[model samples]
Target: MRLTVTFFTSMLSKVVNQINISADLNCGFELACQWRNNTAGEDSGDFLITSNVRVANHFNIIPSRNNSDELFAYTHGPFDGMQKATLISNTISCQLGGGTLTFWYYRTGDSATLEVCVRQPPGSLNTADLRCFPVFPKNYAHQWLFNAVEFPPLTQPFEVVFLV
Candidate 1:
């Protein structure tokens, strides 16, 4: 099960720039599996940050949306059962109003799942408090697909989590 995530966009005035997964600012992944940035080598890794051209050539899939260069990916392996990668974003201020979070994704293989979740206070430990949107790919996707989730207004800061 391999999942690739492209750029993330927020329809908010404060978040004007597109979030880059390659940069270490807001993105983070679990260390239990192999995770790499800017490379698609399958030697031994869980998550990967690679370019659209590189992944397209490697996985025989279409290029990312808008021909974007950077991508965040998670590759599957024999030991993938119960293994997951959690990509966490930096705190987002939602004082004005909650907005939609949109991104393009490409996935291949079976027996894997992807989820989008939001946590308030940024460091909350309670899983029950998370508002999650789960995406189950019934068929393997060969092209990029669009997804968006709308969140309600919140006075406190929150962080978005991508679990795979």
Candidate 2:
């Protein structure tokens, strides 16, 4: 007996915007941000540049210890436990291999964390959903370092986010 062969066709639907967080905070980074502070004097916003990364600005040199010519940092003043920087990204279509959410960080406060997380489409993630890899815990190093977390495979679209 001979075997028969069959073939099926599938069409690609939505397109995914591959995002890489540029040092300028525009790597497809959406600023649906919010913060709670003890006073209104705090200046907290989306991801900002810092001149403390152990790594150089390999992309375009926004701001770093080596290149302090440009001021790329967004701060919440010298306050703590009150000021927060939560960066939320726009939705991105998940692909076969998924993608990575990365950034260069330099820690300052002893009680601060660069919490990395992702959001499922439609609904966002809560603190319980945070499973940060490549964590850069609060350290006085103030040295630039890269944190890259890979997104697991997802059938639908999703967003990558983290708080500073």
lDDT of 1 by residue, 1-164 (tens): 44443433211112223233313232222222111221213123244434432443456543454664443444444326454555555566553566666666666545666778877766576777688888655766566777777777766766676666
Model 1 has an lDDT value of 0.50
Q: For candidate 2, which ten residues in a row score worst on lDDT?
A: 2-11
Cα-based TM-score, every candidate = 0.60, 0.53
Candidate 1 regions with alpha-carbon error over 4 angstroms:
1-46, 52-58, 65-81, 137-139
Tens digit of per-residue lDDT, candidate 2, span 1-164: 11111001011112233433322223211221221111222225433433322222222323444534433333333335454555444455554676664555544444555555665652333445444553654444544566666777666655554545
Best by lDDT: 1
Residue 18, candidate 1: C-alpha displacement in angstroms: 15
Q: Which stretches of candidate 2 lie over 4 Å from their true place?
A: 1-62, 65-73, 77-82, 122-134
lDDT of candidates 1 onward, in order? 0.50, 0.40
Report the error of model 2 at residue 103, Å: 1.9
